[model samples]
Target: MDPTIRNAKLQDIEFVLSGIREIFKIENDIFVYSEKKKLARNAIRDKHIRVAMRGDKPIGFSWFKIGDLTPFGLDYGKWSRKYCWISFVYVLKNYRNKGIGSLLYEDIMRICKRKKVKQIMLDVFTVNKKSARFHERIGFKPLLSIFTMRAR
Candidate 1:
């Protein structure tokens, strides 16, 4: 059976955040609930969240937004238009590898196409290799690599 994709409404914030939190927990990333609450609010406000539902339950979601290029980062002159940044994409563990992520991603791609966004980008922590591979499989090429060094 195929999962249904829909734009997230204000009432769907909690479920979307829950799916995101599960992915973060599995990746061992520290996230403040308060901050997530704020992000959910903003994503909903901007209509940037997409949820994948299996029946009445949400099985995955993608939080995305338009982002600008900073001079310190990529060379904006090389790129023709602003990029759509996929802030997060999370699929329930039990529903993973079932093409659910692909379904959500296609929705984002359609949005980008309609908006004339020339590029789509996302960052995956090195710890989450599965996500990296998934993104690659979906035709997202490597553009940048960011590293973090914790204070000892």
Candidate 2:
């Protein structure tokens, strides 16, 4: 539990993107996907992005933005207050199952509270059972089903 969690800065963009890439490679195997650089440069560039670091090395990261839309796992009509949308959350494979994800989640929730947000929302792929469990454990219950119809 020696990891330090803090708000990321512009100088930390590369490190954050690199850490996310590592997570994607291990968890999703989407080696060619990387829009974090542009996303980082766009809106979140001014907002806060939190990163977890063990000594000088980063092991996980989470980015959020304030919004009104309820993500896939939330009932938007039930709650009308503004929400905090977690854009991206990832932990390095080597650091998984070590409580780092929970730590980061708590930290982000604290931030949300400080910001006076009414709720926190996020989306996980319907097929990722592991991820769904993680979110459930953290008290994010499923609220909506997204159906995509493929053209034959």
RMSD of each: 2.5, 3.3
lDDT of each: 0.83, 0.77
Native-referenced Cα lDDT, model 1: 0.83
Q: lDDT for model 2, please.
A: 0.77
Candidate 2, 48-145: lDDT as tens digits? 58888898887788888876665554565766687888867878878898899899999988888888997887777766677789999989988667
Clashing pairs in 2: none
Q: Ten consecutive residues with minimal summed lDDT in candidate 1? A: 70-79
Regions more than 4 Å wrong, model 1: 67-80
* Least accurate 10 contiguous residues by lDDT in model 2: 25-34
> Where in model 2 is the C-alpha error above 4 Å?
19-35, 69-75
Candidate 2, residue 130: how far the Cα is off, in Å? 1.8
